[model samples]
Target: MLRSGISIISVACLLLFAPIAPSLAAIAPPLNLAHSPITQLSVPMALFSFSGSRPNYLGIEDGKLSPCPGTPNCVSSQSDDAEHGIAPLKYNNSPEQAIAELKQIIGNMKGTEIISDRADYLYVEFTSSLMGFVDDVEFYINPEQNVVEVRSASRLGESDMGVNRKRVEAIRAELNKLEAQEAQA
Candidate 1:
C-alpha cells in the first residue's frame, strides 16, 4: 500500500510538471543574430557586405555592349579574350522581331527584371533564387551584324561558377527554339 501511494504521487508530479517544462524552455530568447547556429546552418546570403557595389557600366558605350571584366564571372560578346568571350545570338529576322522575341524569352525566365528596354538595347537583372544575388545582363541588337550582342555579369561575386555563361547559353537556346518555331509557322 505504501509503495502504491508513492507511485501515484510520482505520476501526479510528472503530469503536473510536463506542461511547464516546455513553457520554461520557451522563456529563453530566440536566436536572431547572423552568426547564430541557425543562420549558419541556413542558406548563405547571395550578396555580402564585402562584395563590391553594383557596376555603373550597364548601358551602351561606344556602340557596344559593356565589355566583360577580367573576372570569369562575366561573359560578353564584345570581349576580345576567349576566356570572357561568348558568341552573340544569331538571328535571321529583323532586329525588332529579335528584340521582341528576346523580351518574351526573358519574361518567361524566373527572377528576371527588365531594367531598361529600348529598340536596340536591353538591360536586365537576374536574381538568384536562394540568396537574391543579382546579375546584370545586357543585349544589343546589331542588325548590321545579324547578331544580338550580349553581356552577362555578376554584381557581387568575383566568380559566379559559370552562372553568367550558363544564363547566356540558356537564353540563346530559348531564342533559337523560338526562331525555329517562327520559321516553321
Candidate 2:
C-alpha cells in the first residue's frame, strides 16, 4: 500500500513540475560584459587626398559626417548617411563643371550612368569588384581635385571591405592621374 501511495505522489509531482521545466530551460543567460572577452578592432577609413596645389577634404560621399548647411555643430556620421543613398558634397567645387569634366573623362562608357547632378557633386553608377564580389558601385566626384570617392555599405563592414575600398580608391586614383596627365598634355 505504501509503495502504491509513493508512486502516485511521484507521478503527481512530475505532472506539476514538467510544464515549468521547459520555461526555466528557455531562460537566456544574463549578459555579463565583465566576464566576456574584449578587444578593439579598427575599420579603416577610405583615405584619399585630392591632388591640387592644396589638398582639400575628401568628404565622405555618404551623408554621414557632413556639416549642416548653416548649423556647423549639427552633423551626422557616415553609418547613418550611407543607408539613405545620399551623397553629400565633400569639396567646395562647382557641380556643373565637375559633371562636364566627368563626362569628358568617362567618354561614352556603356555600363556607367550618372544618377544625380546637383551643386558641386555628381553621383555615378557602375559595376565593379567589391570585397571579392562584383557589386554595383556608386560614388561622387569632386571637380576641384578631380577625385572620385566610392560610397558603399561595404565601406562600413569590418571584413575585407577596407581592402575593397582600397581597390576602388586605386581605380579612382588611376583615373585622376590619367585626367591630370590629359590636362597637362
| Model 2 lDDT at residue 131 | 18
Model 2 worst lDDT run, 10 consecutive residues: 46-55
Model 1: weakest 10-residue lDDT segment is: 43-52
- For candidate 2, give the lDDT: 0.40
Deviating ranges (above 4 Å) for candidate 1 = 1-53
Give per-residue CA lDDT, model 2, range 37-135, as digits (tens). Answer: 542433222112121221133234354223322212121222243322232323233555555655554445433446555554444444232112222
Q: Model 1, 27-140: lDDT tens per residue? A: 978756867676555544442224345677678877787777777899999898988999999989888988999999999998788989999988998887644788899999
What are the lDDT figures for the candidates, one per model? 0.82, 0.40
